[model samples]
Target chain A: MGTRKIVIEPVTRVEGHGKVTILLDEAGQVSQARLHIVEFRGFERFIQGRPYWEIPVLVQRLCGICPVSHHLAAAKAMDGIVGVDRLTPTAEKMRRLMHYGQMFQSHALHFFHLVSPDLLFGFDADPLERNVIGVARKYPELAVQGVMMRKYGQEIIKATAGKKIHGTGAIPGGINKNLSIAERDGFLKEIDQMLAWCRTSLTIARDYTLEHLDELADFGSFDSNHVSLVRADGAMDLYHGNLRAIDKDGNRIFDQVDYQGYFKYIAEEVKPWSYMKFPFISSLGPETGWYRVGPLARINACDFIDTPEAEVARKDFLSVTDGQPNNITMAYHWARMVELLHAGEKIRELLHDPDLQGGDLVLKGERRGESVGLIEAPRGTLFHHYKVDENDQVTMANLIVSTTNNNTPMNRAVEGVARKYLSGAEITEGLLNRVEVAIRAYDPCLSCATHAMGRMPLVVELHDAAGRTLDRRVRD
Target chain B: MSDSVTITIDGRNIEARPGQTILEAADAAGIYIPRLCSHPDLKPIGSCRVCTVVVDGRPQAACVKPVMDGMVVQNSTPELLQHRRNIVDMMFVEGNHFCMFCEKSGNCELQAMAYRFGITAPQYPFQFPEKEVDASHPDILLDHNRCIMCARCVRASQELDGKNVFQSIGRGFARKIGVNGERALGDTDMAATDKAADICPVGCIVRKRVGFEKPIGQRLYDTRPIGSDIEEVRA
Candidate 1:
């Protein structure tokens, strides 16, 4: 018997970077698989010597694409560093509005623009029908709604923060933006419409995806720990709390711990083949230290969502698995929509609060010490730890980003997805592309996590049983 | 310190009292608008069109738009939005925004808005202007080529510390923010203190300090934006 060949070209529709390779056994049972991200940018080392307050400002520079998440997470960590735990009700409400705004734009983008292209347009659709343009052609309304949803969320971010992509909405200790009666009322009015639109669109999506379980079910499945932020009271927290982790059995491992406290349970180590460092719980730190974060992680850790609408969506989400293990690989879409609905309901609640109209914008202050901050970025738990000396000079800095939270688990999940999707196939481009897309389901933005660049190889080859090379090729 | 006042925007009488901008009122009101120059932390420069609104029938920067009673503000008027579109076009023309070639393409604000407003082609001829990028800073970069003159870099410099390192060199058709006194950014007394590079609406200003430290797909906002986590900071 001779060796078989496989090929996948210019993987379609998504952002940033990824690559995957699979090896076969003699009897065709999967022997091994490699997922390599062949580039690196050192952000952990870059944040040194800045003012403690600048963690949110500086680490935010990591990724322009998702600066808000970095900014917020960094702000949270900075607060931890400074040790300012209590927040005024008004301040808390305003900050909630800003965060919800971020969720709206980001979740909408992921569901409609990034992953929806595959599900809505059909993975096998013509290349023309498989992108943003394709969505515009087939479902102009959806495309338009997606754009509007994203735009509205971004607008909220800009209003509350400073700009759209990377705003300074969340500052250590408290928020910087305030609300007026007029501003609050307008957002409230918009929320009704926005929520209605979102519910309609996402419900349509959930239905569409449900109807086509073949693709969803067949794409991939993997088991891993779900790591996230938990409130001081131990409930799952999307923002404003401590780190939490749950294993495959839904067992809580780390709950409501401080940002710096993460060192006790978590560990980071570099692998030679990739720029991204693999991070996992020290408890799970042997060779089997597979852990996950982001959409999969959030869903895994939560018992119930805080908002009413999201809880309803959760029921639908849970029904799919019937309280069974949620494959880490498939949790991407469910996580996105659940957060979207939560964002809508939460923002609506914030906008309706009477205190949103109160006066108390900027808190006049001159800080004299260090601060740390933490928050759940779209991907997973994120931390910004800074140490400022007496002169307000930064002596040390550290940032643990969302992707970093999933670094170890991502490698494992990718292998699972790749093996399941590509192990048996003749290694067609479709299977390869799907494997890559599965990684993107997390929508990783390393830029905000640290700082990074893109480097990938497109190589495919066939070898005979005796090890004589049949063919090999590398792409530009 | 009871700092408070009553102000109205676009016929909506709201009390801003103190420490808030017209943009805050407008945003809370859920109005469709545009802006690029105004940021929450940075002073309002009114450089971009994304937050433009007509105050008392006079076109003004909504981000900095002050609220006054009986003030009739029109945010969605066709004229103002068209002007915003023109400003966006200037951003497109003034910079090398070939989204296909740039790493920041997919998540770029200018690119996203262009898509939102349906400005596919640069109505004006591409300037392809050759602007200098200062890579002196270890953690960031200033790519002049991608700057749309939103003046954000200028504000981050001026307001942040009264460091006027960036100034408009040319007038009208050739207006650009050059280094102060014809000096490179390194000689402008600019420390990492000047965060203008990160705030640039376009790709012109880049962070060289931590270049490509995090790979794509691992970024935070790429998944959930800052708005969703605003309360996290406050709480």
Candidate 2:
């Protein structure tokens, strides 16, 4: 028999489109497998020559799910162009509040809507039964609580920033509006419930992991470098902080460095197969420099969470790693819940602060021509760099998104799972699911990284000798 | 009483004052006729046909067509609504409207109308036309790409500001808003605070030193959909 290939099209339930192809050698043994991203969006090319002020709103179209992250990052970058080191207390708090809402909603979306079915049901359950609708039908209370939690977070975003998606609360120097007493009191009523639900979600995650400990660890776990932003005291910080990265052995690869010298530490390598760029630590080079970002990386890299309840939960989580980095990819769900609870507490803290309602919202200044804005988005560390002329027109722009940072690790996880599960010429549905589950663990936002202007349906084709298409599947 | 006349619009009987255009009558009655170029303060210029309504079995520009007594008008008919959507789609394609990148996005009447119509994507092919940005103005910037050629700024400049700083040049696809006969807006007496500067319905005319101040979501349309003010009053 000639070489055989199996392809799965339109990997479902993740943020964007992806496909997996596994190649079988003549002996019907799995040889090579790849997860290919099919779209390319050159935002960097189109954004050039636009006025610097518009970058904040322009870059937000990158991803509908996480527009707030891009919106805040771009606005922060513009702060440098306008020549401000820090915004006023009121401005800072308002932005932090907005960011907390973003994190809470995004994490809630992933947990309750996207991944909970797999954790609740078996991974090989009926495909139709492993969806949000099924979760609602099976566990009505959990579904309702998740929906309410997401709604509460969204209301905060709407009240504070404006609308939930692509809100324009953050500007170059500061924000336009202040949080009113009424809005504060309104959110205050929900804080207790939000916090409770978040904690319950955390407990659920813990139960899931403990119940499936060995399988979770061996599923997609791998050793790689981890990167995230942290406060000076080594607390988990998403909005404002310095870059910190740790190697697989929990060694400090880089610590407390400003991201302006990012090129000196991080470099991106491009492959022709995908539009997503592979970023790594420059010194170590591509082969071994690949690192993971997002919740797992953030939890591993941080000394402790600043929030009280989350801090207590953190110690329990660290016991799993024995103070070393936890490389199990499934732990991202657990780490995400921990951060969700922290974000709930953070939102409550910021909302009650008197400084948040202050009148000083903006700081006008001179132009600086160049600046870099780096923050930890829900997916991972996001970087937005801009170079403007004296007229404040953008001459150059570079964005390193979270999913791009996790690309190498995601690919590695795909390979690991495929190698572990695939055995013969016949590709079983259960084995295919294992490969997809590996990718879903990272929760990669392929849409954000690709920034595709238009969309096409996901298509997978099987090829034989002379590259003739034998079987094809398409998902719209 | 003699100046008032009654007309049927979308099967609803509404009073119309004599000599008032169909759009003006509909507006006074709290019925929003989708319009782009016909501002209440400005004289009706039927440049944009977004407010086309079927009158007595024929389509007419509501902003310019006078309301006749006992006139049967169809504004929200399925066919008329589709026609209006097409006009809005044409306007979007005629200009380089990157609503994603536009500063006037949330506040833009054009974008809001598109939203009201539930236009996720324009059905027509995008015409990526080459346009110019006249940033020579120290106080204001004019982006030709976003101009729908509605001439609101032209009317605001001539009739309100008393300075003809803006005018329309060329015709057809080549037609564009000009800064005082091809001269830059900076060379003219157009101040940043002038009504003409604020008259643009799109991101064509932007005031310098004041951008994204209101933030996107808190802007005019973000709080509520366009025409909500008029529609809600009657509701």
Candidate 3:
């Protein structure tokens, strides 16, 4: 056999555009596998010379799917610029409510809209039947639950952030509006129903993972480092916290490091093949330092979850791995559901807190010229670093979005799946789908990572050693 | 017949002072004629053309055209309303008015006018012109992106504050507001308390560090239309 190449362009069932290429040797053995991010958007440069105060609202253009994440993250960075080390209780709670709302809606959207079809219909199921419409046709109630749950979360965001699209809620040093009595009451009325649905979704994911454990154990699974933000006491704190990273066996690589100084601990490496930068722990170097982020990493890095029901659910999830980190790529769905439930619990707890109605919203102290804002976004960790001049104009900006943080891990997942599934010269729909399933586990938002826009169709091409096209399949 | 001049606007008779402009006469009658450049306190400039109304078979700017005795004017006819909507839409596309994140969003006259006209979006293609920001001032910001060249700040600086701090320089598409100083608002004698600082109808000249302080529903035009106050006077 001659050396051959298999290409899957613009993988489906994911947020943004990406492609995978697998190289096979003459012996027909897998030689190399890589995931390539093709688009480029210079957002950091685009925001240069803008006023510092506009950053929170301006960064929302980064991704419509997770605009709240960018809005809150940029606001946190601006808080540092305004010289406030802490926010008022009302401001903090309002922001927390907004963030939890974002997390809940985002996770629900990813699971129900993106992942459910693959789970409901097997990975090898007919391409025509493997989609959101198919899921809706077969599981109508689940589809409705997803839509209503997403709407509820969106309503919470609107109440806190003031609007749905480009919210101006989280301003520098504080929030613009505290929760009104009517808004709080409205959300309170629906809290129990939202919580019930969250529980149901959690059960679905957990049951599915447990049922398919044997098949999924080696299905693109790997052992690596995990990174996330945790509270001072090592509890999972999605909104605000210090950095924590643990090895594959759950040994602390670095714990409780301030994210403001994240550059000193983490650095990004550039590769010629992809537009996205590969970030890794500085001490371990690129090869060994690359780690995973998102729900799996967050679940692995934290010692405990704060909310009552989520903590109980976390205990149940941890038992499967004997209190160790769950490295299974497919386990991301179950972990995400755990977070979805936690976000719902957090929203309920925040609605009842009287501090959310407090009047004191903004405060300012000594000002700083440069600062960094880090948040555990729904997808993973997001970083926003900025340098503002004396005129209040931003002279510099650097953003490490969540999807970019998971770049290396996504590639690794693709390679693992390709090695296990790619057996012959012909490319089957099942083989192409397996690659997409692995990458979709991260829920990567490539549009945010690359900051680009355009529609892409899935194109799978098979080529010979001399670069001759053998066979090509396209799915629009 | 009387000492005061009488004019009929939209078929409603109204009394006006001898030297009062059409806009003033309409104001006295509690009839709202949409105007952007003509502020209550500032001298009428008639630059924005939003207040254009049919008078004696011809269109005239209500802010600058003096009302004539027994004159007939059409202020809110369907044709005039569409004309006003088109003018407002042009103002939107001529400049980059990011109402979503603008500090002057709800309070901005431009935005309020758009809402009153039911403009979901501008009909014309956006210019997306590159503009400059003069945030050099410690207490004020001069964002040219939102500047509609209303000259409210220029007139307020000269006539109200008795200071020649702001002036309109350049013409056509290259037009922009320039400070008396060489460059930057910080170099000018403009003070945060100057009338020019607060006279802007848009987000052009706004106080720093106070944006988004007023909650959404409490903003100036949050629950009411732009000319609701004048309309309420009739009620």
Candidate 4:
């Protein structure tokens, strides 16, 4: 059967500027599904040869949403070469606390603000209901829960880092602020309310899933290698750790890999079709090697969660599908809520640490050298690596962002899911939207993709070796 | 074989080694000090009064306070703490800081130090400074309301970029961190990878432009202390 071109430009709800295109054969099989991550932001190249201490500030600019994570990761990356001797214990706790706040707020933003519109209202709901305002109309309570959860997260950040966005204080040397007793008291008051809201929201999301159980599961089932943040002790850690990538066979393909290792295992091949590079893991070829991130990877990577509440929720999560690596991409929403629960409870634990009381804020004693920082961004694993020479100047920098982490697999998964669901030539909006939803589920930050802005109409027209336009579509 | 320096902190005869600032000496002497612009990672910009100490009958910022042989550094003095408290007062009023409505209330350095110094009310009339907030980027945020005018962010932009993407727009209290000609960050050539946002000590400068991506609990600073055992920098 000859192929029939089907187009869905301007991918919706995801961060940054991007578009996707899918091509189906006359047999109605998805012949080519491409996620054209069309943002060319060269943050790494621009950050070269600056003061090592300034990296946290500079790299944080790469993506505004996860700057707290990037800032910490940048600081840690510098610490990998330099040191954090200038920081005090209290400052450390404050930074961790602020990071948790970002995680909570960021995940909430992705789940509730960005993607929940699709989950709460059916994917094929009226376009008006496909937006956040629609969620407020259809389910006012859930919308409120989202606002409260996200607001509390931002509140925590403001309290610790002094700003809701691009906050400072958490760094290689130390943190800037100590949690005040009043701040502690306020957080305590807000925690329970937010947790209750999280529960209600998650339930609603679960209910939505239960309603579409068949569609959700059968919609997306592409498989690939997965990667994420792990503690040196191999624990589930979003901030401060080396990285690990596992193949679909449940075998460890790469362990404790440094940023340089990323260069070896992952390759970024630029296609003229889009500004973003198609990231592929070397062990797996472009087509077969699909990967995933966000809720799916977080649940898969950790042996267990740290919070008791989250642990219980995890079991409930597993029970929904017998818990053996549920690949339902729609589950990203429920998984996101589970992670939010863990964050809320985790905040309480961090707040109570006695050492969190007053201590030296800035060590001001010495500047550090080179280091690599890692954190699990809302999308996947985000890495910031910096090389600073003496004179406190940055000599080199490398950033493996969350979207980049999920690139190879994202492309494959899009095609796999699209093909499986689009087998019938009916071309319902539900089928097309689900394919895009799979990529958005990871919440990829394309602003940090390849660091460039190419001309409009970037399309990877798959031509057979003979150079025939087997498929042609634009990603603009 | 280091030069010995003597200074009196809160009536204690403390002998500080050479190259130790009065702030360092006072801190070594266990003085309760407050600060905003003096980061160990960067050069000292004694803008915040939290670390003000009395030395030789004049108040001095402890972070920038240099060590002198046979010098007297008075920390925790009623007069000095008052001055520090006074500075915090000005900061609280200069910005449109509504503690209850703010996201940084409990953890704000400005709030913590104010409470620490027992500064209850805004001694000075509120500036109620009103400026347009720049939310151009998705992850980072720029709130003009909470700025304390320390210029640390300016220093960061200038010192880091050497491109001078940021500068103080006006003189004195009216001075604000801004791009040249008052341009927004996104409007400039300054790369998003620039960490200029890291130098801000208050909620004024933020990364609000980034969008939804990171999961809820997996954030970097949420569960652990960033400065506890700075040795964890090894992590």
Candidate 4 TM-score to native: 0.63
Please, what are the lDDT tens digits per residue for candidate 1 over residues A1-476? 44443322222333344344455665554555555554466656644544344456556666655677777766665555446565556656776777778778877887788777777756556555677788888888888888988888887777676567655556656666566566566666677778887787668657865786676665555566777776666555676766777777777777766766677787877766556666778887846555777766776667677888888887677677787547646557766777788889888877777766565533324443555566776777776666765433456766667776665555565567666766656655456656656666777654443333333434555555676656664443
Q: In what order do the candidates fall by TM-score, top score first?
A: 3, 2, 1, 4
TM-score of 2: 0.87
Q: List candidate 2 segments past 4 Å from native.
A: A451-476, B1-89, B98-101, B109-128, B155-164, B180-190, B193-195, B215-235
Instruction: Name the TM-score of candidate 1.
Output: 0.63
Q: Estimate each model's TM-score.
A: 0.63, 0.87, 0.96, 0.63
Interface DockQ of candidate 4: 0.02
Give me the displacement of residue A379 in model 4, in angstroms.
1.6
Stretches off by above 4 angstroms in model 4 are: A1-4, A26-29, A85-87, A256-269, A280-290, A320-323, A362-369, A421-428, A452-476, B1-235
- Please give the lDDT score at residue A378 for candidate 1: 71
lDDT of 1 at A444: 66
- Judge candidate 3 at residue B150 and give its lDDT: 93
Q: Scoring only chain A, what TM-score does candidate 4 earn?
A: 0.87
**What is the DockQ of the complex in model 1?**
0.03
Q: lDDT of model 2 at residue B233?
A: 56
Give the lDDT of residue A179 in candidate 2.
86
Cα RMSD (angstroms) for every candidate in the order listed: 14.4, 4.3, 2.0, 15.7
Q: Each candidate: how many clashes?
A: 70, 0, 0, 81
Judged by TM-score, which candidate is best?
3
